[model samples]
Target: MIIEGTVLRGPEFDPVEGRVVVEDGAITAIEEESVDSSDIVVPAFVNAHTHIGDSIAKEAGAGLSLDELVAPPDGLKHRLLRAASREEKVEAMRRSIRMMERTGTASFLEFREGGVEGVYALREAAEGLDVDPVILGRETVEAMEAADGFGASGARDGEFSRERNATAREGKIFGIHAGERDPTDINPALDLDPDFLVHVVHPEPLHLDRIEDSEIPVAVCPRSNLVTGVGVPPIRDLHERTTVALGTDNVMLNSPSMFREMEFAAKLADVSARDVLAMATRNGAQIAGLDCGVLAEGRPGKLLVLDGDSDNLAGAQDVVRAVVRRAGAGDVSDVVL
Candidate 1:
């Protein structure tokens, strides 16, 4: 397969007029030359954190507190999920996955609820889709064993040493939520030595030091935090300390669009557009252990091509800036997953 466009090449996403050659799904080479296409080729986005099961309940609990909206068991999000039938849930999830496909997301790291069955349900949702999902089963060790990893709700919610240990023993990853509402639970979550953490929106000085020392990768969902009344994450600080990726969080709270996530992240942080683009791509892939986030040789051929001449993106002096802060679903021309 040969894809021709202005390829965003390598980790820094340098714009190169070239054609990407893919052999057996792996990028073999990038031949730099003038191409006759006004397409912007970028690495397919990797959304590092998501609770896609909440797709059945989009915009359901408006004006609710953070805890009231998503704090496990009897929370409104869980209540809505419990009320929905398996078929309804699966269909809703499928629609969200389809939307992600149209917006140029190649993969996502899903923090799934409903145990082992939930993992299988998400798989069913993605049966014929090109966009793949890495499901992390919540609440049980068996669920973790059944899925790619375990996703704990938070450190304050419960102790997760058993699940964490089991995941490590089985060579699977374990991720937990921490410091979304406050700084208190950050220590405990960090102590679990999780593979990654989600929503560290309130990291204190000690927590920052710990994050730097442990080299933990944090997946930040700033828009979700803002919507739920929790403060936004320190994206630039976290990015400087460790690997930081962008996520859209619950579909109930926000749309599962990497474009929106990248836009918010780029505008919210003082970081460059290139770094924000990496957060929406390679950094997330690093957190999830995927090799398809960079458009480089010896990587997977997953790519997103947008029409540079589209009304929304035309006349931009900087391609990366346009993609990070301005581009939308309408600008996408093809998703070469």
Candidate 2:
């Protein structure tokens, strides 16, 4: 198969008039030449962090505190998840996954709620879909064993040393939330030495130093922080220290759309458009260990083609800027994932 357009080729996302050739499911070649199409081909997105389990409760708790909204155990999100039937949850999650496909997301890293049952439900929801989910099961080591890894609620919630060790023993991903509300839990979360930290909204000098020294990655959710009244992560500060990626946290608080997350993050942070685009694409893939975030030879054939001539994006002087800060769902023409 051949897709002709202005391909944003490779991790640098350099624009060139070209065609991408795919055989089976891997990209074999990127041939540069003049093309008649006005399409912008970019790598499909990898959402670094998400909690799509509460998808059945979208926009349910407005004006709630960060803790009241999502702080585990008896948080409103947990209550909603417990209240919903498995069938209902599966259907809602399925719809969200389908929406992800339509919006050009190739994969997402999910902090799935419930336990082993929750992990299985998400797998059921995604059984026939192309939008892959990397699930980190919460609550139990058995859930981690059943899923891809363990997703701790936060350091404040419990002692995760055992779960972390179990995940390490199994060679699976281990992630935790830290510093969302304050700098208090950052140290404990860091001590576990997990694969990634989510929502480092209040990292202090010490935490930043530790992150830089450890070379751990972060998944920042700007929109969710703003909506929940927690301060947003310092993108420039985090990016300079270690790898930082973008995530749209909690379906109850925000839509699971990388385009919306990228636009919000780019305009809110004092970073270059290319850096923001990297946060939306390759940076997230880097955190999740996925191989399909960049357009390159011998990589997975996963990319989105947007109509550059569409009224929403027509005549944009900077292609990366337009995609990162201006383009929307309407600009998408085709998604090959």
Candidate 3:
């Protein structure tokens, strides 16, 4: 297969008019040429963090605290999940997955709830979908063994030493939530030596230093933080220290669209359009250990083609800025995942 467009090539997303040759699901070569196509071809998005198990409760909790909405156990999200049947949950999740695929997401890193059963449920939900989900199970070591990794709730909630150690022993990814509402949990979460941390919305200078020393990646969910009244992550600071990726967070809080996440991150942070695009694409792919998210040779042929000539994006001056800050699902022409 050959795709000709203004290709956003490599990690820096340098725009070049070219034709990308793909064979057997791998990118073979990118030949620079003056292509006639007005299509924008970039890497398909990799959503670094999500809680898609709560797809049944999209925008359900209005005017609720973060704890009240999603602190686990008896929280509104958990209650709703418990109330919904298995088939209903699976169907809802399937719909969300399909929506993500339609919106140019090639893969997602999911913090699945409900233990081992939860991991299997996500598998069922993702059945027949082209979008790949790297599921990190919560609650138990057995659940981590069943899934891709272990996702901790937060250090304030519990001591995840056992879970972290177990995942490390198994050579699986281990991630934790930290500094979302306050700075108190950041140190403890970092002490676990996790593969990555999610939602550093309140990182202190010391926490930032620790992150810098460890070179840990962070997944920021700005929209979700704003919805919960928690401040957004120090995305510029985090980026300065280590790799930073973008995520949509809970399905109940926001839709799992990398386009929206990228736009929010670009506008909210001091980063440039290219940097935010990397957060939505290559940065997340690095965190998830995926070989996609870049238009380069020897990489997986996962590309998102958008119509630059669309009414919304037509006559745009800056391609990266338009894609990150302005483009939406309606502007997408195709997703070759």
Better of 1 and 3 by lDDT: 3
Question: Residue by residue across 22-122, what tens digits does model 1's lDDT show?
Answer: 89888999999999988899999999999999999999999899889998889999999999999999999999999998888889999999999999999
lDDT of 3 at 300: 96
Quantify all predictions' global Cα lDDT against the true fold. 0.93, 0.93, 0.94
Q: Please state the error at residue 177 of candidate 1 in Å.
A: 0.3
Residue 65 Cα positional deviation in candidate 1, in Å, after optimal superposition: 0.4
Total backbone collisions for each predicted model: 0, 0, 0
**Model 3 / residue 105 / CA error / Å:** 0.9
Give each model a TM-score.
0.99, 0.99, 0.99
Instruction: Give a tens-digit lDDT track for model 3, residues 204-285.
Output: 9999999999999999999999999998899999999999999999999899989889888898999999999999999999
- Give lDDT for model 3: 0.94
User: Where in model 1 is the C-alpha error above 4 Å?
Assistant: none
Q: What's the CA error at residue 263 for candidate 2, in Å?
A: 0.6
- Looking at model 2, the pairs that clash are none
Displacement of residue 5 (Cα, Å) in model 1 is 1.9
Clashing pairs in 1: none
